[model samples]
Target: MAPVSDYVKIDKNPSLQVTADHRIEVVEAPIEKPGSGKVLVHIKTTGICGSDIHFWKSGNIGELKVLGNCILGHEAAGEVVEVGADVTKLKVGDRVAVEPQLPCGKCFLCMQGDYNLCQDVEFSSVYPYDGTMQRYKVHDERFLHKLPDSMTYAQGALVEPVSVAYHGVERSSVTLGKPAMVAGAGPIGLCTLALAKAMGATPLLITDISAKRLEFAKKFVPEVLTYQIDTTKTNQENAVAIRKIFGDSEYVQPPSVLECTGVESSINTAAYVVRRSGVLTVIGVGRGDINNFPFMHLSLAEIDVKFINRYHDSWPACINLIANKVINVDSLVTHRFPLEDADKAMATSSDPSNGNIKVVIED
Candidate 1:
């Protein structure tokens, strides 16, 4: 590898952006140097996430609207080529997985180690912060986790979503040998399935409306019971179908449910399917208000409904899982694109017919 450059050309930073009209554009901005407590990383690979597609297509995710041109990407891996003052844990040439959310360390939630719940968080790819779709990015050192030598750049980039999955599982308190179900077969849903299995969740079940996605899940985890949800059916009916698919037995109902789709119907189905006193972890980001929520059902069952913001203190566990082959993220990367073709990557990822489980952009 070449020596780290002491000074980089302060010229244009090639970036992928979503215009106000929701059009994908390749544009340029001025490069920035790492500030104190930060590191300048040469982003090697960035995974296109569902949230990115939401922003690219609608120019917003619920209330968080894109006021102007916004660069979109958060799951990224890179090489630390430059370190700023006071950065000690990492140095030049270190490979790292970039954790894109930067929370205020002084907040009450942050002090309690729930930084993801911080009131003032500057997350990448959000309204004010540019994401890692560019060639270079400056991030706080605390948010970057070193990748093991056995991990590829693509796998490193996947750590973000993996962490999200793991955090959901953790919050749900999934017990070993217990039944579990994931509500979607998207990247995060697949990740949740893999993690739940690794943690010893038996007879796993996953549901998705997309036949291609469900087929992909079957291939990913042959033992996982795959269900093709009927959208036309009411949520209560779908919930009944989920239970029936699990079979009629005392151990048939899942005690843990990870609702990864954020769709109202899926969430409602989850609300009904989860066993009494079950744990329901909502991992997907959806509209602020969901109509027809079966609050009475959830309350009557004494089910604990938990929501995860983003992951905090999860990178190390995610890295360990990937490095040890506990989770095979490498297989989830179905499409790869160069940084210049980021627009196409986003387009392909948005289309379920493309059969893209996960799309990555290489620098």
Candidate 2:
């Protein structure tokens, strides 16, 4: 193991901070030391997630507001530069993915294997806890997963979103022959498509308002069908269009519907298109109160509406899926920028017209 001085040049860490809405600045902060059972990581790649864009654009995602000068990032991968006391799992020079959610082990949810629901969990970049946008970040070893030698830093950063996709897919219980529909062409939605295909979901359908995103989805997964939604149409009319695309039959409904857009219209379309007794999983983070939801239809159809928070115990599966080539995430990274241009990166990510899929910030 190397000393902290060898890996860190100075006590201050250069970080990308969201000082206010639509503003990001490079600021210096004191480098946090790794305590016992922790490891200090030199961040290599950080992905600009949709949530990061939400914070950057409005400084809030629904009710969760950024109260002060907050570091803005969570999808991170880096190398362990210094190991804290009693850290045996990882040593210096090991590449790892940072799982930003810290769950309190003593909670009932943690004990029951649903750690993401832990009441005391502290998620990075969410309010009180600072994120991994800085040059150096110290994280508990238990939440960090070691990346394979062949895995790129970008892929490691993707592990977080991949895990999210995996959780949604698992929640929907997508089977080998079951047909699945994903209602967003963003990174997470694309990931959901890949995982659903890997899990044997056939004839996948994906929809989006952006033609660029739909084109990207077509190139990424040529086998799946892509649709460009018309925002001018009503939710029911859009649902009818989707059903028409799948053809008019008694069994036209898909068994699994993954709504990744986080829009009320998309959710309503999902509820309308899903088969009776099928699973409809909401992976996108939308507003706290969703109005005009078709509650009567959902109840009459007995469609299971499941919502996901982050992810729980999905790191290993995501790593293996990427390592084994079950899913290719390398192409998902469309843009890259250094930490110095964090503001530009955020701006690009927030703009849908730029045709950016995944924007990564490299150290």
Candidate 3:
């Protein structure tokens, strides 16, 4: 064998790792160096997503499981510390929001600008892929969107989820004067509601089972209407209540609905309320097989249902929206924690009883 010096171990950096179910700990990990077309970023803030909680609590999401310890964060913002060769767009000291996705550029989907759907894509915080919850990370330069000087690090981190919402709204085609409904007052739902409002969707409405969350959304966008769902009630009854928010007429159905809850009942209620020939975009990830999806109802109404995996080509618009103050995300961050307190942050976010809308970890 050659000299052992060739295998010298790199120094370690602080990183939060999920070792097993309901466990998270800060551990020292190797500091990865940036390679060609990559840049090393010092992570500043990371937002705890629902998917991250799923991994921390059960070590699995849907059919995917974390076979080993994985760093758990995808929504993040950071400053570039070092840039590798040929990285001309970015330099040291530049602040950016991590896109958290690496797609194979050669794929037909990528060429068609639908890179988020690329089958060979590698997403952060997913099984087997280390995420941005570390002190330092090496990422593709192309995936980092520069944060304007006016945007805060926390707002930069929010760009990821906002991007998801942006894509959903774009797909639903919510435009000026179009009535829109968002099913779920969660982070994604709130983001979708804000985007719909920015797109000039009038008489906007948001729904959730949690009164606290609904209240938060109402305050976040004071103009948008909020409704609390009663699980004990039938879908039709709940749909009627939702319609009543706009007016006392049956023709007040929204032309565009964004389902951000992924719950069976919420989706069915959306189907029940959306206008004929309307579009429904599914932004939340739910069960692999929904037993009663109201397929016949959707087919009969000719309501176009669209599903989004993640988001594609949405970072710039989100950044602009936040930077311009057109979409206010500053109020969406309800809880904040330091990097070392990641576990506590996760716990706070997971508890439905608490009023945590978005819990963020700052480095």
Candidate 4:
């Protein structure tokens, strides 16, 4: 039988692979025809994420180790290119968001409706699993989420990150009408700010040192109170600025905090700012175990702390929210590149000083 299409492959070294400098090379391999319960998709827009950069430079993140060269993108939206014989839910030409992580359906966690913690899940852009950086991908039929007629491909790509914010919010269970603070102005941070407002919080305040990102957030989040932290200023000064906004004496203590920056200082700020019984949701992944925190503040303030792992079970609800216009995600993107520029896009995302809000790579 003749193959209908060609797929790109990233060569893998099965042995002595640690010292070898990994690079992504494009080569054509036979495209496997979809089998039962699979759907082939032609990706439209995919975004380079923080995890993607980690894999590109270091090839391993957390417990997931990259054993070989692999495609590197997970946040994506695509058009259904073909469907397997047994795939009935989705047909060709369907516009959908690819929820890149697929958990084992029979896992104990999945049975409890907590699939994100599935022990034997396949997450895209992780080590040993190829990503959606190429032209086409064949995904499990259950993982495909058809987009609403109002949602654009670019907007669909934003769903992955939006899901991250939704999970963070769920972790905090933010009290409506209470004041909240978001300490990172990155894509996830900005997304959290928007989500907070959508949930009825009063003008959630967000802070970042980068003027460009602050400006980007200012465009849609006018109510967002931003502080352009002068890195030259001592941490004490930054803390003082934060205290003044929430006001140690006048206003109610900070009850909710979202630390999305992943910096040690940001975590400290979140801890110190939240009031007694406040909830601080750590949504960022610090470079390492290096994030230092002021434990006394948390203990003294009686703050409850929780951290987020990768998000799951959020795609359908998130897409519905976006399709219903509950949140404006389209404006969050600042740049878009094709998959050919994956390297450049990764480099840009590495530089926090670059001021890019979100950069999407179109396939």
Best by lDDT: 1
Model 4 lDDT-worst window of ten: 11-20
lDDT by residue for model 3 (1-363), tens: 111122323355678888765578888878877888998888999999999988887778787688888999999999887778888899878899999999999999999999998988888988678998888888999999999999999999999999989889888858799789999999999999998998999989999999888889988899988889988999989998888887765566798989998888888899888888888888887766777788988999898999988888889989999999998998889899988788788889999788888999998
lDDT of each residue in 75-169, candidate 1, tens digit only: 99998988888898999889999999999899899999999988789999997789999998999999999998999989999999999998899
Kindly report which residue stretches of model 3 are placed more than 4 angstroms away from their true locations once superposed.
Answer: 1-12, 20-22, 248-250
lDDT of 2 by residue, 1-363 (tens): 435646456456778888655678888867877899998899999999999878877778977788888898999999998888989899888899999988999978899999999888888888778898888888999999999998999999999999999999988858898778999999999999999999988878999998889999999999998778889998888888887777777476687899998988899988988888888999998777899999999999898999998899899989999999999999999999998787788889988888899999999
Clashing pairs in 1: none
Better of 2 and 3 by TM-score: 2
What is the full ranking by lDDT, best candidate first? Answer: 1, 2, 3, 4
| Residue 295 displacement in candidate 3 (angstroms) | 1.2
Candidate 4: tens digits of C-alpha lDDT, residues 1-363: 212223423232111112115555544333446778887777788887777776666766666767766667888998886678778898777899999988988978989988988988988767666677767777897998999888999999999999999999889857788888888888899889889988888647788878888888788688887877768866657767776876657256558888897888777766766777779999987666654567776787678999988787899999988999888988778787766666666667778776777888776
Of the pair 2 and 4, which is ahead by TM-score? 2
**228, model 4: CA deviation in Å?**
2.4
RMSD (CA, angstroms), candidate 3: 4.0
Question: How displaced is residue 174 in candidate 3, in Å?
Answer: 1.3
TM for candidate 3 is: 0.94
> Which of the two candidates, 2 or 3, achieves a greater lDDT against the reference?
2
On lDDT, who's better, 3 or 4? 3
